[model samples]
Target: MDLEATKNLSASHTIGNYILKSKLGESSFSTVWKAENKITGGEVAAKQVYLSKLNKNLRNCLDCELNFLSSVNHPNIIRLLDVFEINLGMMFTEALLLDMVLRKSIWSSSASIMLEILKQTVIYMLSVSIIFHFCKSEYLQSQDECCVFLVLEFCSGGNLASYLQQHGRVQEKIAKRFTQQMGDGLKILQSHHIIHRDLKPENILLSGKESDVVLKIADFGLSRVLPDNHVETVCGSPFYMAPEVLQFQRYDCKVDMWSVGVILFELLNGYPPFRGRTNFQNIKSSSCLPFSQHILPGLHPDCVDICSRLLSANPVQRLSFDEFYHHKFLRIKGVGKYHGQ
Candidate 1:
């Protein structure tokens, strides 16, 4: 629960040539750390996970993450450098050396610098392949405690949540910059058949510069590879989730489109489309609101139209990924204007 206690428990733990320096992050099933390797004298992000803590199904999910990272060759996605086995109940993942960018943001002096970092991050994501992998070694040790560790790119900027908190709501000009880059990133993902089920401000991490803000769609725990036909999963955050998901209907990548719509809406509206007194009720009735009425009168009608189609409850009627690129909102935002009209 406390930092000191965490050090006490994992202080003696070692994975091959890397010595655990200090814990950087800890979740219910895994812990990440900043460590220096004695063999290479280089710093690396080490994620230690207890596979025994995961249920059978979730253990399989962890495998999905490992397999995805290992095989994927994407600048935006985290790289898996090496893996280590710890006794029978634990395993440590040594990811490609990367710093905690969130902590780096603490040194940033202004919001402009932070936005620049976010801009570069989104660009990096555009150049890589979204691959999938599976790690069975942890599961082999202990099914009950199995877990997967993700070592990602070190963006000097913090997450979108912290960026928003520090800078508050962004100006229209700034939001357009973000929307353009984010739209580009989403298009790349769609090309690869990966749907980022969770697409919210928090998941959209910044690099650490106002003009250099590059956005990366992180945290694919709820994401799924579309089958030849269609896959169904009733999962995602209440506020960013699509109406079809909330209704428990069969949906495709359109769910992700819905999330993007919500984000764009928030960028202009200064709040998520759905917020309720309680999360339980919020999930039940959030996506039903009409954006046109709630949106600011100054927003271009085309922008509102594109967002409206994206938020449509009917997946069939929702804006397709291709259509999104050519939408009036994207055009007004200067997304695809370079090539032609």
Candidate 2:
């Protein structure tokens, strides 16, 4: 049988030297798998995307994702080890090249992991990558029945949303710690002109051994580099979205910070700040709620301050990136009790 015909022989199959073990996740245009490298005994994630399912929009997004991963190198972002193409429904096939994928998943949304995040980010900032670091990115080709495999680093600690749902919301100190790490990572992304339009808890992954878990931002499907002009896409989850996004106004990186505000509020308060019976009502709640005064009662003063500024109705009045880098709330040593409580 031809390589393409051979691959089509099974839904549960192997591509190159990588064997598909199990599925990790599936979205509109892609499905992720927990795969293994036959030669190395190493675990990796392959984002399997069928070419047939991609519309122009998804294709553009896929292109953007490849470009960003291939071009950028940060410890927090998923490392694109290799990208290659193989025929799934065709007759001819090619082998794969390149090796070494990053191991370790996102850290859990808790105190220790976030602390690690801050520590690592600070360390990276201190050290300089004076020379260009070369990382290989491979692409796989398949048919109408073809697919593209995006081999990504595996994150074992899983995503924050599942963690929160499983363990319930954390206290103020723990929540603040995790959010601080998020700010650190987000600031770095912003510095590189990358805007993660969809910045929810789920997109954050926690990876590490049982003793230590570290968080990393994942799923760049909705992420994009900053455009020359103001962005006007009315995208993002309704509950965590900025007022301006829902209003379809020109916005920038501040939108992600707005998401941070919502995530922080939920982590600290056990529910989102905006509550509504309908989607429209929820969008409206972003503007109408007195979040500043309402959320301040039990959180630490600095916590409330940051959260309020982040959740500001006016995008221009929202907390800037530098503010997060030097925020007093993040600097406080140890797990101090919530003072405002």
Candidate 3:
């Protein structure tokens, strides 16, 4: 058997040098697994994406993910280790061809005509295959069920979203610590001119044991390199999305600071500052930061100041990356030790 055939047989449990153990999470087009490196005996995350399930926009996001993760190395950002592709099987390809023929109501066509259709379909699949960075001629020959696997550093402590769910609101000192790490990561992104359009708690991960867990930013699916000109793409989760993005205005990296503010607010208050059933509702409700009456009075003045400025409705008034990174709130020292509530 050839390499593709070998891959098809083993890919259910293994890919490259990693043996997939259990599923970590999944989305519409991809699944992430916790895997063990066979040679090094280390843990890692294996994110697998099915090419057939991707649309044009999703493909672009995948390209951005691969490009950004491959280029950067930061302690506060998730690291990409390896990437590879696997072909499902020839049987799967034939099944897809049959399904297409049946859908078109051409099942009773002549063998020569069916052969022509099969050839055309194979050509189409191959054309789509070229969009991937790791496309191999041999892998394209299978013409169906190709999966791209991204090996990444594993975070054992789950995401900040789940952490928040388990611990509710965190103390100011802990929240500040998390904010500082996020700032450190954003500094790297700023240097690279990359904007993490999605910066929710779900995309920030905890990577160590309880006593000394470190926060690392993950999930770059919505990230993009901002050029000199602004981009008007209205993308990102509504709750943490910037007001400018929610209003569909042209935006730059300052939009990310707005998201950071939302995350910070959520960290301190146990819920986002704004709640809405739709984007318009979110924008309408977010005209002002609705700090909890009970919690607002107790927060430090600098904390309140930074949050208010970062969450400013106008991007121009919002804190720039440099300003945010060096804000007095993040630079403040000598806070009392925080014991979890």
Please list the C-alpha lDDT of all candidates, in the order they appear. 0.63, 0.71, 0.81
Stretches of candidate 2 exceeding 4 Å from the true structure: 1-12, 91-143, 209-211, 275-277, 292-297, 334-336, 339-341
Query: What lDDT does model 2 reach?
Result: 0.71
TM-score for each predicted model, relative to the true structure:
0.70, 0.76, 0.79
- Name the candidate that leads on lDDT: 3
Error of 2 at 127 (Å): 53
Minimal lDDT window, size 10, model 1 = 89-98
Global CA lDDT computed for model 1? 0.63
Model 1 lDDT at residue 248: 73
lDDT of 2 at 90: 35
Residues 114-203 of candidate 3 have per-residue lDDT tens digits of 777778887866764554435555445335567788999999899999999999988888889899999999988888888999999999
